[model samples]
Target: MKYIKIKRVMDFIFSLILLIVISPIMLCAAVAIKCGGQGPVLFKQERPGKDGVIFTIYKFRTMRLETEKDGHPLSDMERMTRVGMMLRKLSIDELPQLLNILRGNMSFIGPRPLLIQYLERYTPEQMRRHDVTPGISGWAQINGRNGIDWETRFEYDLWYVKNISFLTDLKIFLGTLAVILGTRGVNQSKSQTMEEFGVATKSLKG
Candidate 1:
């Protein structure tokens, strides 16, 4: 569809512009992470994108290097640092995903990429959310983000799949600004993040 093509162009242009504009902030974030003695400034993870194809998603590291002296991974709260929390609350940690957008692995507005393990868990209908490229922000993100349940999130994803258009993307683009400024749904008040898809486990970051 023409809209899909147009959306890709928009993603490319916007991601490039955003990267240029935010480079300084990203630089500062990298310095802060290094100063905090965290493992790395950027966190890379394999996430499923369109049609369940895996791609590396990037984010600024927001967790401590280790939770235990024995090389064990840290629990969500244990790994969270003050700097990490501040970046997360400001939604600055996700700025690295603009690179994903530029790389053609993602869109600026679509269903947010999810973990690879979720490929097997999604029902046939839920899997439809992957019909388009995954995004850094999406209809689901603007709706409730980390606060919403898996079922509802999937519903929003599916809705976007069926209703994608320039106007829809514009609305999401604007709504994302509001969400970021307000930090309304970075994490659920009852918990740090929504439970993992079909797993009930917490995530690395919200």
Candidate 2:
């Protein structure tokens, strides 16, 4: 349990320092978002955290609030503004979640939090991901991000839960930084943002 305590301390300290270091960038992103369109600068959504606890996760708004003439939502691709696309491609949209880490709502390394509604869809085995606090950067994200299939993503998440350690967290942190630094691209929409986890699937059946 030493490393677990270390992880929480690191989450608080590093998140605080990084937020201060990156405040300028976050501010610029906010300004750009405002200049781009009419919408909130931050996109806050309810996500499941440790042990299925619901919490509001924050990210920079990376899409426009565009609706059709009839006021229905537009497709993700269609609603994505140019600035938003660039922000996502550079992984800058995730910078705000550093605050979530500092706030104890998330960890620096664990399973990335997913939609609250996906709670009931997970099998008992898959639901094991909630055994640890959710994270901003995780094993699944450093692997293929949204490019991988759902089953594969869940597998990586569960693996992380079972094998978490100081070295594991360090490795994931370095790997995620490599992604943000352009050594590896974190494509948020190679297919799409893995948003279709609402239905129970046979792959998740015990």
**Candidate 2 local distance difference test against the native:** 0.84
Compose the digit string of candidate 1's lDDT tens values, residues 1-206: 99888888888998999899989999999999889883878999999888788889999999876756567654665668889989998988999999999999999888988888878787788889889999888999999988888778888999999999889989999999999988887876443454677766333112
State residue 22's C-alpha deviation in candidate 1, in Å: 1.3
Quote each prediction's TM-score: 0.91, 0.91
Q: List the residue pairs that clash in candidate 2.
A: none
Error of 1 at 117 (Å): 0.4
lDDT of 2 by residue, 28-57 (tens): 999999999899999999999999989999
Q: Every model's Cα RMSD, please? A: 3.7, 2.2
In TM-score terms, candidate 1 sits at 0.91
Which 10 successive residues of model 2 have the least lDDT summed? 183-192
> Stretches of candidate 1 above 4 Å error?
67-74, 189-191, 201-206
Best by lDDT: 1
